[model samples]
Target: MNDILIQNTTAFFEKSFGSVPQKVVLSPGRINIIGEHIDYNDGYVLPAAIDKIICFAFEKNDSKKSKIIAIDLNEEFEIDLTQEVKLSKVVWTNYIRGVIKQLQDNGFSFEGFNCVFSSNIPVGSGLSSSAALECGMIYGIKELFNLDIQKLDISLLGQKAEHWVGINCGIMDQFSSVHGLENKVIKLDCNTLEYEYHNADFKDYSLILMDSNVKHSLFTSEYNTRRIECEEGLAIIKAEFPEIKSFRDCSEEQVLNLKNKMSEKVFSRVHFVVKEINRVVKACEALDQGNIEVLGQLLFETHYGLSQEYEVSCEELDMLVNTAKDDDAIIGSRLMGGGFGGCTINLIKKGHENDIKSKFSNLYLDTFGIELKFYDVKISNGTTLL
Candidate 1:
C-alpha cells in the first residue's frame, strides 16, 4: 500500500521538477488507543502508528530556495532558506516552513530542496496528519543533507514546529509517528519521554475508526482551557501535598480528599486526569495478558471519563458510543481525539466489521443527517526513509 503511494508521489515529483527525487520518506498518522487529554498532564498514553501515511519524495537543489508541491491539495509553494521564515497563509505550507524554522533554530544548515508529497491520512479526523507531514519533511531533509539527527530529535522538532504554528500539541503524535513498531503500541510517559512497546495483536478483532465528520472550531480554545484547569487543579493539590509532582502522583483517594477545597469543575477535571492515568496502567496490563475484552472495557471507561468528567465529548460523540454499545460485535467504542467532534475508535469482531460499520453509518445519518466515515487501520511501523 505504501509502495503505491511512494510510486505515485515519485512520479509527481519527477513530472513537476523534471528529475527523480533522491529520497523518499513515509510518515504515518497515529491513533491513541486508550488515553485522551492526559498527555498534557504528563500522564501516560497508549498510541500506535497506523497504515495511513504521508509520502514525500524530494532532492536537494543547487539554489538556496526550496520548492514544494502538495500533490494531495494541488498546491505549490517556494521558500528561500537564506531568508527569515514566516508563517504562510496557506496552512499546509506552515507545517513545512515550521519544520525548516525549527531545524534552523537547532543549528542545522542545508541547501534548499524541491519535493512533492501526498497523503491518505484523513484530515480533520483527528489522526495527526500534520505531524506526519512535518516529520516526513524533517526526516527527508535529514537524509538528503546527511544531518546527524536521531529519531527522537526528529519527533521533538516536529512537535516544536506544531507549537510554532500555535497548536501547543504534545509529543505523542510525532513520537508514535517516528517510533512505531509493527504489531505494537507505545506506552509513552509524556513527562519523562520514556516509552515501552506493548503487543497490540487483537487476534480476531479489527481496529476501526468511525469519523463523526464534524470538527468544531472550539477544539483549540477548549483544549487550552482544559490545560489551564489541570494546572489550577495541580496547583491546589500541590499546595497541600507538596510531594505530588503531577496528576501521575495523585491517587483516587488523595484527589477525593481535596474535592471540598477545589471548585466543582476543577475537581472533575482533576478526577478525570488522575483516573485516566490509572486506566492506562491497567490497559497496559490487559494488553500484556492478551485480554482484548478487558482492554475494550477500559476503552469504554476512558470514553466515559472523557465525556462526563473531562467534558470534552459532544452529543454526536456520545451518540456514536451509545449506538456501538448496543451491539455485541463492538467490544468497545469511544471518541478518540481532542473531542469536540471526531472519530470513534472501535474494537470489532473481525467477521462483523462490515455489519457494524453499516449499522453505525445508517444510524448516524438517520440521527444527525451526516454520514459516518470509517477507516480500517492496521498497526504499522513509524516514519522511515524508503
Candidate 2:
C-alpha cells in the first residue's frame, strides 16, 4: 500500500470504527483499444487494466451495520443490512447499496463492515471507474470472509449489482477489472465468458488516454436503445437463419442475404457490430504478427465507423482522432468508451510522448476551448489484495 493512503485510511478507520481495517484490496480501470459496444453482442474486445485503480481498506464489524466513507470524495454513506434501500437515486451510496442487495439476493450472509474507499481513477471518463470500485468491494469481502467464489462468478454478481443500480451496462467493465493480466490484452468472448490473452508488444510505442472533459449522462439511455436495435437486427437475421446465435455467429454473406429484412437503422447498427467484430479479429492477428502499423490502421478505420455508423463519436473525440491522424508518429487513436463523450485511446511512439501530448493539448484547446487530460498507461495486473 502507498504510505500516505494507508496512513490516512488508518486514521479514518480508527476514528470511525475504533479500529483499523484487517484487509485492503485494489481493482484497476480498463481501456479498450478498438472494439466498443460489442460486448453485449457476444463479440470480441481487447482490453487491459491501466495503472489507475480503486482501493478499499475494510474490516468486518461486530455490529450489524455497514458504514462506508469515500476518502477522496469526502462523503459518508451508510446502510443497515436489515433495511432495504430503494435504487432510484444517483447518489454515491448507490454503488455500495447495489453490492449489498446483490449479495443478499445471492443468499450470502451479511454482517457489519467498515470500509474506506478511495481511487486514483477519474469518474465519468469512460475508464470503468464504477466497475473498479465494485470489483474491489467484492474482492475485499470475499477475502475478509473466506468466500471461495471464482473471479468470473464475482464479475457476474457485480453485473447484477450494476443492473439493480439502474445503469444498464454489459459485462466488459467488470470482466476486465477482475481478469486483466499484466502486459497483455484479454480478448473477451462476452457470451461464453471465456477469454484469451494476447501479448501486445509495442517496443517503440505507448498507450495514451486523452480525456475530452464532456460528461456522458445520456449514455445509459443511448446504450439501451442501441442494444435494442442490435437485438432487433438479430431478430430479423434469426427469423431467416435460425442457426445464427449472435452477430458474432453471422458472416458478411449472412448479413447481406438478410439486408432487405432489416430496417435501415437496424442495418446500420448491425453493420458496425459485424465489422467491429471482424476488426477485433484482424487486430488480434496484427498484434500477433508484430504488425503495429496494421493494427494502427484498423484503429483509424474503427474510429470512422464509430463516428459515422455507430453514431457514438462526439466532436471532442473526432477532433482528437483527427489530430492524432495528422501526426506521423501516432500509430492509432479511437474513442474508448460507450458514447457521446469520453477519452480517446491512442498508440504513439514512446519517444514522442511529450511531443504527442503537447500537440494534442494545444489542438484540443484551440479547437474546443477545453484542456485535455492525458494518461500514458501500461497494461497492468488486475484486482489483488494489497
lDDT of 2 at 370: 91
Candidate 1 regions exceeding 4 Å error are none
How many pairs of residues collide in model 1?
A: 0
Model 2 Cα lDDT, one tens digit per residue, 59-143: 9987778888998888887778888767746467787788888878888776888899778788888999988988888888888
Per-residue alpha-carbon lDDT of model 1 for 14-116, expressed as tens digits?
A: 8888998899999999999987888889999999999999999989888999999999889999999999999988888999999999999999989989999
Candidate lDDT values, in order: 0.92, 0.85
Instruction: Give the lDDT of residue 60 in candidate 1.
Output: 85
> What is the lDDT for 117 in model 1?
93
TM-score of each: 0.98, 0.96
